[model samples]
Target: MEINHLTAAEARVWRAFARGETVDFRESPDEDPADGGDWGAERTLRAGVLRALLLDGPRQDGEVPSLSVAGARITGRLDLQHATTDHPVRLRNCHFDEAPRCYAARLRELNLSESLLPGLVAHAVHVDGILRMTRTRFTGTVRLGGARIAGSLYLESAQVSAPGTEVPVLQLNQASVGADLSAPGLRTQGQIRLNGATVAGSLNLSDARLGNPEDAALDAQTLTVGGDMLLRHAEVHGWLGLRGARITGRLDLSYVLLSNPGGSALQASSTAVGELWLRKAPPMEGTLNLRRAQLDVLFLEPDSLPQEVLIGDLTYTSLVPHEPAERRLPMLERQRDGYVPHAYEQLTAAYRRVGDDHAARLVQLAKQRRHRNTLPWYGRLWGLVQDVTVGYGFRPMRAAGWLLSLLAIGSVAFALHHPQPLKAGEAPPFHPVFYTLDLLLPVISFGQEDAFAPSGGYQALAYVLVLTGWILATTVIAGVTRTVSRQ
Candidate 1:
């Protein structure tokens, strides 16, 4: 390709490429292309000319070969598929007529900040330095699947929208970023997929607004992040699927608004993170599934809780706010499944770790109550009896109180009506308290019971005392046994 007979803008770009100088067409750095400026052939450059300059450009004596064009219009498809370029391409504030195709291409660095592009297809592209698109707008899908970036991939304040399409607007599936993949304040109308992607540093998407009403807005299943995955204050209209993801650092979702009615808002099942911050977020519209996920610490607030949650086998070492069981039990009660005993047990353990034995006991009691709801009527009745009598083996003082009450009742009844002696003068002295004790003891004979015989109602009363004594003894024994076994 002869680089002669080029337009003024193309000639300037060719000259600047060899000299490593930026060819900015805008009067001001912040001026956009649509800000009342003529953008005809005077400011237009064919993509092929730029591609030729990058591939076979004249090298100056001392200056490095680089392509930096700002506030210009690129007319043709910048197809650099399978091509290798050593130049750093910075096309800031530019408008592209067609999407650039950099499939399987190797480049030093690429920055498309503040540019308006129809789309991008850079799948399997290798960037030695950072791949930046800060404040850029993409009207079509931005595919970066299987790409490897040695440095960070920045997309801060970028807006990507594929209107009326079900496909992902930004695809980073299986892409490997040696450093951080920061995209704070990103806005997208379609899905943003990062499935199986690996980020050596943190992956920040704070203040992002992702919308995909039909499907998941952010599908990051199996994604691995070495540092924190921050999504604080994000608004996700569709599901945010993080299933099987592994994050070495904390996963922050504080103050996020998730909405996906009748479906899962956040599907983080089987994910493993060091810490999970879900504080101060409003009530979500859909289920928050954390089934089988494990985290070192879980920062959750009562008001941030969703209507339903799947916490079966979700192991978290600690809970934030350190609230009492009364406040935390409500969260466990919202389990998606009918009743999950593991969630209650996990909450109980968390309380115990903080040396809050009272709170731990309360959680244990709540667990039993929840479990009782899933049983048959007869079983529930039995559970209720145990609960009312001794708090299901958690309140031993209730047993002591019942024993004293029964003792007093038996004594008063026997004292009111004394029994007749069996063997006249040889009978032991009649003591009402001892007689009542003898009837209630079941095993021990106080001699007063053997010496006298109660007739009619008194005899019936004595039998009633014996039956009540047996019941109390059985229940007390059961409670004690359960308590010991738990300890």
Candidate 2:
């Protein structure tokens, strides 16, 4: 219950300002300056008086401000808890001793450009217009959690630095904004959390510097954004987490410099987006983990792909350049620990989903070839032999091709036999094709192999055909088993 004291000249300034009239430090322009000698001294205003004026003041449409108090430093905390106002609060280059706690307050617009504030607590506060804080410096944490904003929120070139190390500098958890959230050229120390927040327009953070070496710098878990999240040409020392987010537009991180060293730079697990743009000149340098992400278009250049990035379980519908199976080689080649089965499988499935079975088989073939090359010398030899005979279970028709070739060669040898007789002459079913099939197949009995009695080279060739049948049949069985296990 502290009372605010005002001087005689300051009393006149407040009366004129509340009446929608203009007044300088001394008096009106018609009054003489010699009437007030101490008007040249600097003025100090209490926080309670500023809060009262904001609640009771009426804004007239003119060149004059609604409540313009220049060169005055606020003493106590301006607690406008749940107060509703319609006028715009414009405070320029002023200093606040404590943070203005406008919790659940309904405001029209707030323009604190070039001001120095300790912090700001506007949780669940409704604003119909923009919250402009251009070039302002916030020494403490600014929590705008659950706030609803109709217009844009501009923090252009602002500096928000908290005293602690691990906590977030700006908290916007569950906050909903209708327009853009432009924080270009902003320099912040701790993390900027936007967990479960919804932004209707774009979030342009281009050319900003976010540094938090201990942990993630921007934790935007489950954030639903209507437009782009532009971090182009920005620099982040910590991680960028967007796990389970739904972005309507592109997540543009082109030319963004991020370094988290051993940890993940961007963990976008289960995120659904229209397009993911990482087509930078030098590419991103950190470990980008995009597991379980579904994107319509993913634009990635060959040179820009990082050596340690991972896209396991990621499914993209349309890749650029039309031929994605061949064009996506650089990304798979850049894996750190070599072959990842899910990455290749996901890409192959995407191509198959688009009705490109030819490209899908090519991707499967490429995955096997690249994986075999990374194996040891003995393993590579075994893999190559399996591929030549059976196509690594990817082509079961190759095993059929081998069986048909052997059957044709053996059929020609037996068809030109010198002496071929039937057993007991009981109307023998001995033909070239039926006898060859009996020799190739182990289970089927066409009574042609036992009925025919061969001599000279035919008998010796029959022994080779019997062994070749088992080998080809075993190869086919092995190929089928391998395919079943993979599925």
Candidate 3:
């Protein structure tokens, strides 16, 4: 494989490479410097017709030092398939107006660091190592679908602007990364899809901005992150869907702002997080649906502003119901009987912060259900009285008091009607002893007539005294019993 100069047709290929069009070129052996050094060794073409071109061939090992396509306006397709190089390939400030396809192009490293391209269609583009794109601007849609690489894919501070002529911005379908996906300060105009993608390391999306409101900003379905999924400070104008995604470590969405109106702001349903710290997320119009999601511990630290942290019907059961007695310390622990009530209380507080009175009331009712069996003593007593008043259609306490007062009055009337005879010899029309025997037992006996017998008026007075004492004793006993029962 000797070094060859660019012919008329080959010069056209060289011109396409200069214009930033996709090209597949084969490698050629470098001429010995000891010799007059093949003057046409380096490939060069004048910049003009920027269109799609493919350059492919076999090159001598260690021939080309670098593939430099510096400044040109290349439009249409560009494919650099299976091209080997020792040093970095630089495409610095070239303008690619159309789609530039680079499939299976092997290079030491591709540095499109500060290039202006409308769209980059690089499918299965294999770099020998990393592909660094720092501050590169993509004016139109960019697709890297089904690309595989052994090293990291760094896109730090890359801006993906929406096309002015009604076109989508970026799509990363089924792209796998062996290392971290550091897209910090990544701005996308249309939907960014990472469905069915696998990242061996962390997926850092800090300070990323998704500008599309109607379309989903981050569709990360079934994505598996080997490390933590850091989305801190990420602003999504649309929904951030992480449905069925699995994060091996903590999922930190601390200060993420999700402002989607129609759909849920954050749909992490069926996703698993080792630990979730959603401390201060931006206000969302819709619910943050996390139903059926599992977490080791969900932290809800207090925030400066009053924020409502809605925890949807989450089923959280303690892994260890009973800790060792020696390890247990007395703190504000939620007991078995109090777990449901405490959870309900927390839910109520959250809803109340957002001024959702209906939700708060619903939670309160659920709490009441938890304590249904254990009513306060006073409450139970009040309920009993009400039931008695309504059930039997009789106020028993009021009726009993009225009947007792009437019996006392009748006794007094009888005593006044039939006054005891002054003379005992003239037998009294009625022997008062029968009625007075039970009442006046302490004062008199039957056997001792002389000592037992008193004047008739005095006997009447004794009867009155006995009756008053008996009534007072019964009333006091009844009052004491009622008080003890209530307590």
How high is the lDDT of residue 83 in model 1? 97
User: Model 3, poorest ten-residue lDDT window?
Assistant: 325-334
Q: Is candidate 2 or candidate 3 better by lDDT?
A: 2
TM-score of each: 0.96, 0.73, 0.55
What lDDT score is found at residue 219 in candidate 2?
Answer: 92
Question: Which number leads on TM-score?
Answer: 1
Task: Give the alpha carbon lDDT tens digit for every residue of 216-285 in model 3.
Answer: 7888888888988887888888888888888888787778777777666777878877766665765554
Candidate 3 wrongly placed segments (more than 4 Å) = 1-64, 69-72, 81-88, 103-108, 164-168, 302-366, 369-487
Ranking by TM-score: 1, 2, 3
Q: List model 2 lDDT by residue over 186-279, tens digit each.
A: 8899999999999999998999999887488899999999999888888888899999999999988888887777788888989999888876
Per-residue error for 329 in candidate 2, Å, reads 4.5
Please identify model 1 stretches exceeding 4 Å from their true place.
Answer: 34-38, 441-451
Residue 169 Cα positional deviation in candidate 2, in Å, after optimal superposition = 0.8
Q: Candidate 1 — which pairs collide? A: none
Candidate 1 lDDT by residue in tens digits, 195-298: 99999999999999999975899999999999999999999999999999999999999989999999999999999999999888889889999999999999
